[model samples]
Structures are given as structure tokens and as C-alpha cells.
Target: MKQLRVKVTNAVGLHARPAAVFVGEAGRFASQIRVRNATRNTPWVDAKSILSVLTLGVEPQHEIEIMADGPDDTRAAEALQQLIASDFAGKI
Candidate 1:
């Protein structure tokens, strides 16, 4: 299992578009991934699910924790961390 802590840099946070991007990326990995707001009381939610991610209420500058458990856990965690750190490439 692997875990990463990253701050969301996207201007609008993980809303619709960014959440969709994140869900797509997570789906590419053969691992179970979950996410939660690191600085809040939100419970961990399935990272690959758009609805679950959106419910997180993540906002810009919100620190989030990503956890992956499986053969590709490390890669999954790293990729997601990079994606959030880069603000989803300013796409959303």
C-alpha cells in the first residue's frame, strides 16, 4: 500500500471536470485508491468514483490524502499526487 499527501492547486478544486479527470486516472491503475481531505474531518472515499470524490468538498489549497492498495499502489499514488500538485494541468 502507498499513500501521498498533496494540496489541490486547481482554481476550482476537484469539482466536475477535475473530479472526472481524477477518476479517469485512478481507473487506469490496477489498485484500490481512496481520498480524503487531510486537514478536515471528511472520511476517506473511493477515489475512482466521481460522486464520491465530489462529495469530499475539496477546494483550492485543500490538502488531500491519497491511498492506494494493490500491485500498482505506488504508481497510482504517485501519479495522483502529481496530478493534484500540477492543478490537473489547469484543465479544470
Candidate 2:
């Protein structure tokens, strides 16, 4: 398994459109990915599910932890880290 912790810097944090973008990016990987709101000390949730991610209640400046386990775990973790690091960039 691979894991990373990153702070959310987007204006709206992970909600609505940003949540959708996050879920979409997570779906692109073959690895099983999970995320949790580190700042909130929330339980891990399915990164591919919008509902699950939304339950995290992530907000701007919140720190989140992501984990991936599978053949592409490393890439999956890194890609997600980049996505959040870039504030979802062009994808949002």
C-alpha cells in the first residue's frame, strides 16, 4: 500500500464540483484508493464514491490522507497527491 497526506488549498475544498473531480480522478486508477480527513480524524472512505468523500466534510486548509493498494498503488497515490496539490488544476 502507498499513502500520502496533503492539505487542501482549493477555494471550496472538496465539495460539489471539487468532490466530483476528486472522485473522477480516483476512478482512473486500478488501485483501490481510500481517503480520510486527517484534520478531522475521520474514518477512511472510498475515494471513488462521491457520497463517501462528501461525508469527510473536508474544507479548505484541511489535511487529508490518501492510501492506495494494488498493482498501481504508487502511481495512484502520487496522482491523487498531485491532483490535490494542484487544486485539481484543469480538471476542476
By TM-score, the best candidate is 2
Model 1, 1-92: lDDT tens digits are 99989998778888899999999999999999999988776999999999999999999889999999999999999999999888787556
What does candidate 2's lDDT look like per residue over 1-92, in tens digits? 99999999999899999999999989999999999999999999999999999999999999999999999999999999999999898777
TM-score of every model?
Answer: 0.95, 0.97
Clash count, predicted structure 2: 0
User: Model 2 off-target regions past 4 Å?
Assistant: none
What TM-score quantifies how close candidate 1 is to the native fold? Answer: 0.95
Q: Flag regions of model 1 displaced more than 4 Å.
A: none
- TM-score (C-alpha) between model 2 and the true structure: 0.97
On lDDT, the candidate that comes out on top is 2
